[model samples]
Target: MTLEKTPPASADPSPPSASSLAWARRRGSVARFWKEYRTHRAGLLGLAGLAFIALIALFAPLLVGGDVQSVTNAPGTALEKPSGEFPLGTDQFGRSLLGLLIWGARISLTVGLLAAALSVAIGTLVGVIAGHYGGWFATVVMRITDWFLVMPTLVLAIVLATVMSRSIWTVILAIGVTSWPTTARLVRAQTIAVESRPYIERARALGGGHGHIMTRHVLPNVMPLVLAQTTLGISSAILTEATLAFLGLGDPLIISWGGMLQDAREAGAVSSGHWWYLAPPGIAIAFVALAFTLCGRAIEAVLNPKLGVAR
Candidate 1:
């Protein structure tokens, strides 16, 4: 028998490069997530609605013909009913209701996004630390989280907003600070579960550092839950800001859907049967909230199989 010369060890094929492996992993993750997400019809609709709203906000100036002041302060057009000249009619300030609605969408979306990001960041840090350490640190962190949890979020947010300057940043901060406890609890529970996995134990045995393991391993596993919570958080943050604005605590310099509602109420639009003033903003808020709720539910269903089964 002729023996074929064996290839030297140095000539052995190399394993995939680290960068290629990482790219493949990320591509797989995104593909899997999209597969799951596409199965839910309501999620798709909600996503479409959100995208439409974002587009309107992005092109508000162009849509309004770049005359923001004319739309926002047309004193000559005050209280005009919907007509060919102004489709959505003018507010008490003679500003185009359509213009105000478009602009308000921008503010509401911005605050929602910022507040959700801040809340998620704080919650993730607290949860990761508490779950990873699991000692006096965990006890202290959980206690603080519980303290915030027991308080009514809206009431706490209102109080915080009142204490700070009435500005967009103030509203964003107030909502974020008050909104993190639930996320912290969720992340902590998920982290604990992930930490107990055999792979994590193997990592620890291999002398993996806490920061490295947590960031590289634990955080990725917990991110689906974080994403679901973030969608819900955006809706809640928007509603909370609206509540504050309706109560006359919103930034005076900015127009918002809630501020429009407040102005309509103060101007007796509802009592005077001016449906044009009251309907658009209320509908906008309700529509946006419903969209977020639908999307969040769909995400939860995908991430938590139990919920899907129950549904």
Candidate 2:
């Protein structure tokens, strides 16, 4: 039998390169996520609405001219009914309701994003540490979380907001600090479940340190839940900010949707039947909240199949 010459070890066919394998995995993950995401029509619509709002906020100066103060606070044109010059009408301050709405989007979205990010970071860190280590650390963390949970989040946020300077950053800090307990509890539960998996045990057996296992293993698994929570948290933060603004606790210098509402109420727009003044801001707030809610629900459904109902 003629034996074919064996290829030298150096000439042996290499398995797929690590980079290629990683690329393939990433592509597959993205595709799978999109597939799941697209199944919800409401989610797609919500995403579209959110994108539209974000774009408007980003290009507010270009769209409405760079003179925000002039457009928003035209002293002579205060409460001008919708006309050719002002489409959404002017508020009690003579500020173009449209300009206020546009700029307000930037403020609301910024506060929501910053607060959600801060809350998620704190929650994830506490949860991972508590879950990974367990024992006394876990007990202490859980107890602290419970105490926060038992306290009314909105009330606590209001108190914090009251104590701090009336600024966007203060609002963000108040909301983030008050909001993290729920996320911590959620993350902690998920972490505990992930920690009990066989892969986690194997990693521990292989002499993986707490940091290594938590970062490399536990975090990846819990990320979907965290992401879903973050999306939902945005809506909550926005609503909370609106409440504060309506209650006259918001920064006096900034114009926001809630501030618009507050101005409208003070101007007796509701009683005076200036539908344009009250309706625009109220509708904007509701629609924005609804959009976030839809997106968050879709994410939750994708991550947790039990929550996926035909909708």
211-247: candidate 1 lDDT, tens digit per residue: 9889999999999999999999899888888888888
Worst 10 residues of 2 by lDDT: 67-76
Name the TM-score of candidate 1. 0.91
RMSD of each: 3.8, 3.5
In candidate 2, what are the lDDT values of residues 1-311, reduced to their tens digit?
Answer: 89899867777677999899989998999899889889999889989999999999898878765566554447446688998778888876677778878988888888888988998889988888888889987998899999998999889988988888899888899888888988888898999999999999899999999889999999999999999999998998888888888888888788788877888889999899999999998898899999998999888888888975555
* Deviation from native of the Cα of residue 239 in model 1, angstroms: 0.6
Cα-based lDDT for every prediction = 0.88, 0.87
Off by over 4 Å in 1: 1-15, 69-76, 309-311
> In angstroms, what RMSD does candidate 1 have relative to the true structure?
3.8
User: Residue 68 lDDT in model 2?
Assistant: 61
**Poorest lDDT segment (10 consecutive residues) of candidate 1:** 67-76
